[model samples]
Target: MKMSKVFRLLFIGMVALSVLLAGCSKSNQATSGDKKPNELVVGQDANPTTMDPHDTQDTLAYGIQKTMYEGLLGFDKDMQVIPVLAEAMPELAKDAKSLTFKLKKGIKFQDGTDFNADAVKANIDRLKDPANKLKRASLYAAIDHVEIVDPYTVKIVLNKPFAPIVQAFAHPAGLMISPKAIKEYGKDLNRHPVGTGPFQFVEWKDGQYVVVKKFDGYWDKANAAKVEKITFKPVPETASRIAMLKTGEAQFIYPLPPEQTESVKGDSNVVVDKAQSTIIRYVVFNVNQKPFDDKRVRQALNYAVDKDALNKVVYRGFASAPESAIAPKVWGFQKQQMYAYDVEKAKKLLAEAGLPNGFEITLWTPNDTIRAKIAEFVQQQWQIIGVKATIQQMEFVTLTNQLSLKPEESKLQAAVSGWSPSTGEADWGIRPLLSKNMFPTAGFNSGFYVNDQLDKYVVTGLESGDEKERLNAYAEAQKVIVEDAPWVFLTVPDNLVGKRKNLSGVYVLPDATQDVVHAEFK
Candidate 1:
């Protein structure tokens, strides 16, 4: 009540103190400092089928191995094709059918093996070996062989002038490993991996984890991984993985549960790193099957499911709604094409396909949580259209092997399968997945949807190096898949990555390759 100047100043000071206390209570920074982890650990969904880079198609293998190896060509941060191991990008012969690579001198493999033309030849020979059973055999099937021009240079002879040559070498499937290391370790490379990579294998506990230490001899060792050691422990269960992160038992994680992504949105210790990915989830329908053979049936399936509903109720809005078979992040997406959800339209289509009420279909899905959830959500949506889908769950390995069978032998009707990009290769979305030429064997085209136009465009896309021509060809290919509806394009993804604050350079590719070098735990 006393209006003295000193009292007024005291009252103002008291008000300031109150505000400061309230601010301190809410301030995250006041409690503690954010400390970076000392090592970078990763969680992989699966183990590598082969440690030999040339003989494996498993993406997890590539992700872990890339930190330890280099390709003749590489994609920069901008996805521009450039030289990595080579002195410069390979020059195509006048005919453009032959690729000549000039190697960098004084380069050494992790095993201290000489890196030369002979080393390149040995690696090429191993990739060509049929006994290896590599998943990417088709990518190299056309290669005539490697010809060493000299110790520092070599030439690759293709049967024809195959374009996308720069793209081919940059794919994780195409990275080079030391020939000496392969000969010494053979397939036991997992336990004793030797590469030009920045890290060296320390131990691997199958289904548990893998550990690696920094290889000080790496070409970019000074700027390479900062961690002294890394451990990759597996907690396959979604809840368990998240629980590990909460307890600080795990420093990094992947594919954070759809519902749990929000938990790390702005935390001081943890972070959610989101990026566009080449992964697309969809329900793959076998075109060779009876009901699916009818385009109307495929359209019905696409129309019945509300992708918005799936993203909301199932994915909790953590995923984006897919519009086309090719992801929007990938070049050549056909924007005008998408199968809109129309319950009545789906019903009419089903009726047109001679099923007025509904049809029974078997839906196969992996035992994993996300995939199972997607299948269940799709199953619910199908019920609205009178289509009853019975869920059959199996492990990924068994499920994938089972899916790759003759339609007659498949014993299941429609199944949920996802497509992923290969260094942003449109062929990853087209040929090997939809062409009759790749039916049930070469790749995911287990559905055997043979559109002559898709096949021609796929070939054309793969045959041309011109960006305009290739993109135009892929655009046409996307149109074919959308119109054909061989599969219900569900959602393209933003990769869900949760990491400790200290890890830098955690390179996650638009494709599936994950790199740790250039990453340091500060």
Candidate 2:
């Protein structure tokens, strides 16, 4: 699908206007050169909505929380599961129904609490408690209970055979919090964190910065922090973040804006780091709403837009069109045929659906540059097919609230968002977003997408450990989802970062989380 001349001109004009606005905007003059050598300041795109790991759904918060918390299992840069607090890899039962882990002894939380089987059981119990209402409960719903075998050993008994257990523990939601703190702070634990990781939480000045200091008694000395203190500062403006990096105001920054990648590459003071990411972007349709409820209307929307153009224009070629519902970097990802761009086909589908004149919709998007651009481009494409789209851009928090509305109460027609399988597996990639059991307030199924066949296929994949069986199940699942057209699949963006030349051991993981524990200045 080639981009129309008018679309290309609109994109160029938008880019020029953004550049002009950036030039006219005032810049902050703060510099980090005078700071102590042992302190590392990092800039992120936005402030995390919450500091509590279990309560957070945002990626930036998880990255910062990881520095303070340690999970039984962890993921390396390649997204492979490895042991962090556990003595070694867990022992799985033959039926894939249970997993046993040997806890590492002589470990203590930052608050001087003992780390043992009891602590593990306590955390799991809290998550499983229906009264707590944690958003991640669905991921662990298969767990029947946690059995304490000994002071240093624990067993997780599952209600059924679940294949993604290990990957689930490696997720940020899987990161363990201090049981003692859970008791002491209770609901206030979101502001107070105690963990056994290399860094201990210092303070979180909401909407400004989160501070952490080194833990002198960390268990893993080899992976311990090199710096005494690390500060995560939220700098929302892309140009301001880049300027800070060049001026030494920030030593590192996650998500170097895609449009600025080439410009940053030529800078001698900054080095560009890239990782294959599991983050997939798409526009989700509210299937419970009018026009979108019809499969033909959904499929027509997918056919109207050119995904290749979206990647090139919005991502500056830093992304690729998705071949599967999940990114190829994730485990169990299977390739499937995607929709080809066809304006005429979209028109025909709309006519067949008894709406030859098309319909009007309120398209919601966060006020981020990339998402806004994608929304604008899509709006133009849909206009060609007689669809009138009114874009409503809001703050990230506001957008989240709107998306989180109950299906019956929601007025949203469509929304532009992205999902990263923080666990780096297909189960985490597809289940929460597409499954019938994951509707809002439960999981992230905000679009209210449901298909009986898809739900069964997802369960079938989880019920076995056999590679071929899971592959076949996921392949069928992908085909069903594509045919349903619940979303206009966009791109799997590359994880790009910018850091000072002297910074060492800081990089974005394939799951879009940061491994900043071993970071230091050269």
Candidate 3:
């Protein structure tokens, strides 16, 4: 899974070239009085691992996939859920098992195909397809059947009254696809996508760039992206991303670190915005390991690490100390009143576990400044407890692979990772990472830290859309995770974006949306 630096560098260079093309494009003919281009050019670090919306599990993938696909529901300016493809929120039947959705008419796929109830069926059936190979298949497994009541109406019958179904539609796995496109292209439809969205797929040069063009036939063209062509360039380094932003080589950076926030504060031409991000960073314990297998050892690790110090040194005060896996921005988040940085307590717990002298363990992270610095801080903290720590770094996807190994097949002892909340809820952040049933038998829950009590609360939170009930369930789950300490809860990131003076609409919501979607020059 590793590649030579030469190829990686070349790939980066090509991405730089793509950015230059987007910055210099004359196609679609959008220009200002100063003759600036109308096309919105964006930059990222790498190509999305998978373009198939349902197969991806990262913010980058969700951000890109959202551009070309519309879900049954979508988040608005305030991140409030509203109907898009759906004319109205589904109405629950008296039986409570059947949900009926009224579809919006006059919507057409990018390929001039009509969109109706049949299209909805096609979209849902694909993700529900047993052979689809989509990672999110489990989300829809309980769906009994979908009946098309009319051209503009569809009814979904579930095995149970799943109230969170509306929010689930906002997930990438629930993005609506063109039935004709899928039927014609089969599995390759991900590469060659067709949807009823603001943008249409144009070209994707592997590991370099992904380009999309505006669709003239979009239903709501008024708020349709102001720009013409949108090109996303993969630029991995923060300094490089910030440097290029200053040069006007790139208009918007996905995330300019907190370290650079103050640097850009004085620059009138550049603006920096910060808000609590739904993404939470943390270090996970491999429960299969003997020391970590003991709840006392896990809790001790939590007490040993200084999250505040780690936040200051690594995140430059751009993060909030997370008491649990879910961020403070989420509704009904139980604030862990205080994080215990008790060296004596940690030592005592280790002694109780028959390891007074401490033990050696591997702490793994992806190769990045924030990750590496955080690992160094944890390494120092572990040292105080008389434990020798070995720090290792790998690619983000590689780390995902190691932690995703099956129970008996896992090689990782512990790793640093976190979730980017795609659905803007704790249900997404906690369930998929900790719940045994959410991930495949050999997938992300490779830590195999099963707690039926925790699973019950997470499921309860997800099954009911009733705000009070869901929030209470989430609060209970957070308390359990804090006491259990399967992972060292770190901090909630502040979404930081640096944009040139000319760029407009550079916004960040604490959810899955991560792209510079509507960026434009004044």
Candidate 4:
């Protein structure tokens, strides 16, 4: 009886050992096959409206496009232009009216088509084509035509000498798309974009997330993506986005509200990064509208704005008071205090404009938390000057459309808007906001403020080959615009970004776009 009992015990032990070995083998296979930890997830406030690079001007779309598209040139973290798909910087002709670029050979789009000079020409042609009506069509107005010198070389002939054209190529207007894909998909190309970027689009679940995976066959594989996959999820609510970052549900979040920066710093798993940005937040006057047409009234409004108070209250002292329409980061920004906050001065200007009793006006602002606060503050301050201001809120996209309408068809008296010149040049900062050429349908000029003297200086600045001469022209333009008070120059907010402590390689460009090409979790 003792021998039989010992045999039973030995059999049971052997069975238990086999079960343990099988469980270990299964776990190893599953880990190797599927649940890898090389994926990164990011949360942002908005979803991209379209994938077609040329069809949209939304910053969110540009952020997503950067992952999949490669322009002829790109900007470094310091806002300097660098060649991306081009073998080198373009060779400028002596007159600066033409540019020749040599394309990098052996590069192919995600759709497996060769990227050649023809592809570049096709993109420019599409952008300049009036039928397409791209929101950024005016950006390429200087380009007269494109000529292909060879399979790898192309020449761009300009109608005028445009000094900022090269930098403009680094903007979204310069992003290249697969011509083959465009032809096949037509207007539906936005749904299935193909590019020669480091990441290839996998799927986009509307209002939820966009998924992209590393393209192993990318041309520059050495500096290619470190993470295997990236999932960009749209968490519009600020609290929810912050919660995701804290819980590791999202590895990165951008435009981190300044009020929450301190709270985020207390979290052990998150880090906050701040950088000087070229973004300018200001209130645009509808120059075509009533009392605003009078320079005295506009100047009165500028003097009435308490920018210092706004920075401290709305931005939590994280923003700098703007001295000019162009942010200080732009090349030719000149420091000017044309209209300092002085309630007495504002009242005097209003009386000088024949309105001792301030009139009623409506101020439009987007339905954003910080902007809402700014609008309310402006209303309270204007009341001190005897002006009755009513605040209206709308979705950002709707607000943009409302600003785009013709003055006669629109009811925009004043609107709070922001501008970030994508090219990091003073010309872009000034021309789109003050030039008559940009009025009516041009996407950037919401104010329709026109001054012939400003236009002359802007044109001269664009055509000048000498750097010093260009700077002088832009400086003069800035001085005139500040005096004109087309906009109530407000603040230059720093680009605040939040990320998990374990994340690395995330970069914020000067224009406030996130560079995720090399982003990864440590």
lDDT of each: 0.75, 0.86, 0.76, 0.85
Q: Between which residue pairs do clashes occur in model 1?
A: 68-197, 358-386
Error of 2 at 38 (Å): 2.0
**TM-score-based ranking, best first?**
2, 4, 3, 1
lDDT score of residue 180 within candidate 3: 85
Error of 2 at 17 (Å): 41
Give the per-residue lDDT digits (tens) of candidate 3, residues 396-513: 6566667666776777788878786666677777777888775443235657778899999987886675779988898888888888888887777787877766777657678636
Which model scores highest in lDDT? Answer: 2
Candidate 2 deviant stretches above 4 angstroms: 1-36
Clash count for candidate 2 is 0
Model 1 agreement with the true structure over 82-175: per-residue lDDT tens digits: 7888899888887778889999888788788877888878877777787765556566666789998999899999887677666777776677
Query: Lowest-scoring 10 consecutive residues by lDDT in candidate 2?
Result: 26-35
Residue-wise lDDT of candidate 4 within 1-522, one digit each (tens)?
356888899999999999999999866753332233588888887666778888766666778888999999998878788999999999989898999999999999998999999999999999898887677788889999999999999999999989988998988768899999989998788889899999999999887898999988899978888889989987756788887887677778987888899999998768999988888888898888779999999889888989999999988988999988888888889887667799999999999999889999999997767777889989998999999999998766578778877657878889988888888899878887678878756656778888999999999999888899999999899889888889888889988899887788887787777888888666
Work out how many backbone clashes candidate 1 has.
2
What tens-digit string does per-residue lDDT give for candidate 2 at 405-477?
Answer: 7788777789998898888778888898999989877788999998999999999888877878998888899
How accurate locally is residue 143 in candidate 4, as Cα lDDT from 0 to 100?
A: 97
lDDT of 4: 0.85
**1 versus 4: better TM-score goes to:** 4
After superposition, the stretches of candidate 1 with alpha carbons farther than 4 Å from their true spots are 1-37, 46-49, 181-193, 404-412
Candidate 4 — which residues are off by over 4 angstroms? 1-36, 203-207
Best by TM-score: 2
